[model samples]
Target chain A: AQSVTQPDIHITVSEGASLELRCNYSYGATPYLFWYVQSPGQGLQLLLKYFSGDTLVQGIKGFEAEFKRSQSSFNLRKPSVHWSDAAEYFCALGYQKVTFGIGTKLQVIP
Target chain B: DTAVSQTPKYLVTQMGNDKSIKCEQNLGHDTMYWYKQDSKKFLKIMFSYNNKELIINETVPNRFSPKSPDKAHLNLHINSLELGDSAVYFCASSPPGAGGTEAFFGQGTRLTVV
Candidate 1:
């Protein structure tokens, strides 16, 4: 089935450390990819998206994602992590109806 | 001003009761959707309305129905709600397309069935 997969269910990083969240898609062709973040008691906020363009896409909150066609992956990354970055992250894709992954919970430590 | 908004930020009701959650998007987008976020924080697409037309309906139960009076408003009504239905329901809107574009989301409505 065509879907998005986030390998890591939970990740913990120290403040000021780098962060990477892995995402892979199993689609017949490259569909639009997106990364969204949800803070506690909040709605899902779009961090970044990938369409038909350059592989690397920059998003809000000092985040970026690289879409690798060969690997079918669009992993989100940040140069340095912050405590406020601790939240639930979701990777999604679709052409008409968007689908989301289970989500990855990030815990940032000071 | 909020781009997307859902009413009744918190709802607590008994099982077997019926309820409705209203959603509106002032962004003037043509596509609106209803998504259910389970206790585990897993998001699932329930329904999609484009220009007030039902475009996508997942394998959701008949008890859950979505109504779109126009392109700007989409409401979800649940009949005989069950305890298992307790979760955070979100309403989102996007530009005329699919998941390819970023969606504007409203603060979810947390529903509790006791």
Candidate 2:
């Protein structure tokens, strides 16, 4: 079955430090991958997505993700973490019916 | 204006009560979906509608029914709600065509079943 996995359940990073969230997926074909962020009491917001062309796709809020077909990974990265970046991140895979990962909670330390 | 909006941002109800959550999207997208976020924060797709037609339905129980009146509206109604039903529900919409596109999400409705 196709699934997405975010190995880390919770991560803490100091402000101004770089951040990377890992995501791995299992699919038969080259699948559509996405990263989304959800803040407390707020709906999810799309961070970035990978479709066909470039392996590295940039998204809103200075977020970017690279889709690696070899490892079936689409990991999100940010150069510098902000205090406001504290939120839950989810990795999803699919075109129409998507499967979401368990999600990783990020806590930014001041 | 909100691209995708769900009514009743917060809902607290007793078990066995029937309740409905309404969703509307002004983005003119043809596909809409309902996703459930459990207490553990695991998000799961429940149902999807494309142009008022049901396209994807997960293993959700029969007690949960979804109705789409138009392309911009999708509603979820739960019957005989259980304590386990307490979770945050989100409504989202995407443009027509492939599913890989980014979806607009509503603020979400936090349902607490007591």
Candidate 3:
């Protein structure tokens, strides 16, 4: 069965600091990977996705993710974190049926 | 306009009652889905429809049923709702094809069983 794992349950970073959220997947083949962000009382918004192109993919809100086939990882990163960046981040894997990670709550501190 | 929307942003009902949640998407996508977010904040896929046809149905209980009148609308009807059924339900949509496309999500409906 395909599964997504987000090792970090929660992460806190000061404003303007760099950020990285780890994600690993278990699948037989290179599956479609995605990073989504969910704000409090709001629905999820796609940050980035890796299908079959370059390893590094850019997304909205200055978010970027790198897909590492060797490690079965698709990690999200941002150079500078902002107060508005505080939210729940989820890593998902799928093409027909998707599986979401437990999610990581990001807290941006000033 | 909202790309994806679910009616009854919040719902409170007693156990054994039957309720339905309506969802609609104006993005003209060919695929729609229902996802449940439990109290633990774990989001899981319940069902997916493509072009109004059932495509993916997870291990959800038979009490829960999804209806898609068209490609733009998908509704969930729960019968004999139980306390364990209380959770936030999200409606989402995507373009045709495999999961290569990013899905647009609704604000979600918070269901409470009392």
Error of 1 at B65 (Å): 1.3
Sorted on TM-score, best first, the list reads: 2, 3, 1
Question: Quick one: ranking by DockQ, best first?
Answer: 2, 3, 1
lDDT digits (tens) for residues A1-110 of candidate 2: 79999999999999999999999999998899999999999999999888899999999999999999999999999999999999999999988888999999999999
True contacts kept of 1: 0.85
Candidate 2: list runs displaced more than 4 Å.
none
Chain A (alone) TM-scores for all candidate structures: 0.97, 0.98, 0.98
Could you give candidate 1's per-residue lDDT for residues B10-111 as a string of tens digits? 999999999999999999898999999999999998999889999999999999989998899999999999999999999999987543678889999999
Candidate 2 chain B minimal-lDDT segment of 10 residues: B96-105
lDDT of 1 at B85: 98
Docking quality (DockQ) of candidate 2:
0.81
lDDT scores of the candidates, listed in order: 0.94, 0.95, 0.94
Superposed model 1: Cα runs more than 4 Å off: B97-99
- Please write out the lDDT profile of model 2 over residues B1-114, one tens digit for every residue: 999999999999999999999999999999999999999999999999999999999999999999999999999999999999999999999997644787789999999999
Q: Listing every candidate in turn, what is its Cα RMSD in Å to the true structure after a full C-alpha superposition?
A: 1.2, 0.9, 1.0
- Model 1 alpha-carbon miss at residue A41, Å: 0.4
Write the number of the candidate with greater lDDT, choosing between 1 and 2: 2
The clash count for each model shown is 0, 1, 1
Candidate 1: tens digits of C-alpha lDDT, residues A1-110: 68999999999999999999999998887688999999999999999999888999999999999999989999999999999999999999986678899999999999
Candidate 3 has which clashing residue pairs, if any?
A: A95-B99
Q: List the residue pairs that clash in candidate 2.
A: A95-B99
**RMSD (Cα, Å) of model 2:** 0.9
